[model samples]
Target chain A: MPRETSRDNMLREKHGKEIDDIISRYPVRRSALLPLLYLAQREQGYVTEAAMKEIAQILKLTPPQVYETITFYTMLNLKPVGKFHIQVCKSLMCALVGSDQLVGWFHAKLGIKPGETTPDKLFTLSVVECLGACGTGPMMQINDDYYERLTEQKVDQILSDLKKTGACPLKSGPFMWPEARSAK
Target chain B: MPKHELILLKNMMTPGYTGSLKDYEKTGGYQALKKVVGKVQPADVTQLVMKSGLRGRGGAGFPTGVKWNFLPKDYKGPKYLCCNADESEPGTFKDRQLMERDPHQVLEGIAIAAYAIGAESSYIYIRGEFVLGAHILDKAVAEAQQAGYLGKNVLGSGANIQIYVHRGAGAYICGEETALLESLEGKRGLPRVKPPFPATSGLYGKPTVVNNVETLANLPHIVNRGPEWFAAIGSAPKSTGTRIFCVSGHVKNPGNYEVPMGITLRELIFEHAGGMRSDKKLKAIIPGGASAPFLTEQHLDVKLDFESVAQAGSMLGSGGVTVMEEGTSMVWAALRLMEFFFHESCGKCSPCREGSSWLTQTVRRILAKRGRMEDIETLKQLCQNIAGRTICAFGDAEVAPIMSTLQYWRHEYEELIREAEAHREKELPMAAARH
Candidate 1:
């Protein structure tokens, strides 16, 4: 975790302006907690306790108030997720389309199940609810972008490409490449 | 496939809707605003809505009139009326359908609601991801403004209602009314603690009414068709009107189905959704999105209404019905939902933040063929702690999947654990020592 001093500075420098902008939009200050956290998280990869404390201070809220806001929604990650945080959609629509096998494959390749960061810190895998892209199920989101219609072979190729490209890989939503074989 | 039923509810969803003022005017849109403006007092409108028993279509089933009534008539500050278009709930896409197909309907609904609530300005808080839908709504609002339906002196009645379409930054929690208001204020989408409720203290600390897209869509019809007509359609005595259920998964026909409130699950799936897709028989149904309690084949005949579903130990949440065929494992399905709640958990409370993680881990342990008999009981205990303890229903939403799955499919979980134990014994032989 980043130290409190640096986190505080980041919140003051980046999140402070964003928090002001968000709070100004709302007639209420308490509602600014979510966006402030988002801005805080973007400034720092994950929300440290220090950053959360500062957020509470900035919003004229208690630490619990900030904690309650963070705990209510799922998009904000408090702990450090890997450089490429792989979020697989394991909800009903995606499950029917074979999200399980893909998840298992990720477990094998990454050596970490959902919620575990890889030893090398290259990836952190977690399962999410329906990403609202049910039409393209068996999908995974890496960072901000989405990758749909996954297969083991495709997973292998995608991993290889991610390994090759230090930067986040481009999204390839199912239609781009056919799976090696039809398990069906 | 409902074959796109164009009932009185979907009057504004005509194809090739350009959202132009002339187009909406030609279609007899905004006439209700013209009809209700001078003729209807805000209290009379509120009474009409109260009599109709129009509960919020958003997750909470609070009565719409009651919500509007909560706004302090004595307060002289600026109040807001927010249209919650952040349709991020899993399996729930009814709002998206309403917005995409019928933008003007929603706008008209907003106008009626603003008039009823005594609000001068309203904001349609749309989700960021809904680019197309937002565009349609934005254009519709602009058209309503041009047609003297949204701006100052709407329909020449001197009741000025200015509607602004505020786009959200793609957060699911914003679907919650207060969170939607917060996001509309250009903040991150996080839910607020209730009690003061939006009607009393919402949007900018004024008395705001944050209604869902579907709930607001019903406003114009309630004003135009009369509340009595709406009350007569649905199943419950207090709850009125048709509900749009977005049926998906393992079904032959999966789409948005709008039916009278008292319709049965059997009718919805077999008659409306065209039954299960494969030869695989129905295993279970998550009747009301991921948050609601799961129902087995036994509850298929249960009436799909808020009260009936609640009586049966589940809610008619967002009316997103997901079907699971026999080929699917109930254990996996439950785990999948748990995983969603785990990842989606904003991680504020120890019970929910930690409990969801624990549930997902336990489910994974069970699925990975590394199961313990004690883990099942621990899972139940964890769920017990998580439920009703958090700031939002999210904690309770997390519990439904865990408890419902265990209640309906305990045998399946036992089988998975036993299967895993056997596999561990055969493969590792000394795997027990590792633990």
Candidate 2:
């Protein structure tokens, strides 16, 4: 509905066979919507109208159907987020262990609040539900990787490191949320 | 500390155990699948699991074998075994660990469960945020297929067990079985009304079995060792098997610990999890996930079994023990969990959608020192009205924190209210003149 900048069917054109493979896995074509949505999000940072329309066409659903699903899911952004989308876990487990402080540190460092992207479009901050990394309480997911057991200094280092290297070396455990010292 | 025969997390804790096909095979995995696939009858497999006294690790605590048997006996067309990897319950993280660290264990379990239920294909509906876990599972599924443990004619048993990992796009309600089925159909994750459970009609209108990751991961181990072996392991008869308690919050060692089910809350916290982070005395414990009711330090010796925890006014719902020290505020904790519920309430049912917001606001107001004594009564009525009125258990779950807190820590709520009353009284005369 916003300016339809992405006119091309980039989702279908680029991820045709891959999409086909995913669709084939399910008995119904519609079931591939989540996977295709993921692909669209991966191809671009956020899902575009053109992508949703294309997904609807591919899955044989109405645009509203696709739009409704997009709206329901928190991860599927309607607009483009910054290069690094930092989703801080604000659920009770993380809350108990200084996630609010982690959020404050992010605010001070980024000059932006939750649900806002930086002017430079480098980092986007959003408060999210538990990512199930409960043990390592004060955690955030920057794009795909998790940055856990955060402190003010660690948050500063992570941001600075991301700004410099396009990635944070402190990103942790896909499998294990290691002890703070061991993680470092 | 008492010993635990950690079947689920054993391989991951082993020295340099790569979770590859080779590593899983070396660790005596898939032996159960091979033993049971063609040799054992489907009903008999279910019987074996039933005998093992295995119950669902995901909140409900329903017997896994009984669940498998619910699939319409012989009318099966396209039955599904949906592994509920949507471990989004706040304070629960055992599923992510199982999938990421020991993918084959889960995959093997899925294969066995599918064969047991006569389901050819199974889908692991993993939480979308678990990107690494999903990727690991995808690779594991591929590896299992290549090794003939999955795909057409598994292990020459003529059992075509195929496992696929499906990712949910950040909806906690999708963790609910019927809601999960709806999402699997690429629709909004709204729950369907009961009468026709997933076992009767599920996943594209066929019979289905939705199971938890931790529950399914136990299948292979149960099959390898006899039913008697598993049944004898945990708290007798009812609650059987090792539970991976995700100890978080104000704990010295806040991590996953797989122990026998009968351990007391005190033993779990003090011995297994290394006690409170500081010298601050223990205040409260949400013995299960955020959905379960909160327990105070008085419930320290309450055993972590499903029935015992339920007897203590909380279910062993997902085994996510969240400890809070004396410094923490219970009302604030309730507010935090209420906020999560308010955010995640899929607006299918009016009671949940509207009640969650109201509950959250009331709790928030109390925590912020702006609440009245009447608001406490309002909160109680709201929780009561909402719990049993929804299509899903979410209604009951969302109210757990508020209801439990009000029950145990009534004094804290009163203290806040009294402060609000005093503050309001002081400001009243000045406000009256201004008005």
Over B246-301, each residue of candidate 1 has an lDDT whose tens digit, in order, gives: 78788876666678887899998998777888788888888888899899899998
Stretches off by above 4 angstroms in model 1 are A1-89, A99-128, A133-184, B1-5, B12-21, B184-190, B423-435
| Candidate 2 residue lDDT tens string, B173-214 | 999999999999999999999979989889998999999999
Report every candidate's CA lDDT. 0.75, 0.89
The fraction of correct interface contacts reproduced by each prediction comes to 0.19, 0.74
Q: After superposition, how far is residue B418 of candidate 1 from its true place, in Å?
A: 2.0
Candidate 2 chain B lDDT trough over 10 residues, lowest sum = B426-435
How does the DockQ of candidate 1 come out? 0.14
Query: Best candidate per DockQ, number?
Result: 2
True contacts kept of 1: 0.19
Give the poorly placed runs of model 2, Cα more than 4 Å off: A177-184, B425-435
Tens-digit lDDT track of model 1 for A126-167: 876676655346777776566765677777877888878854
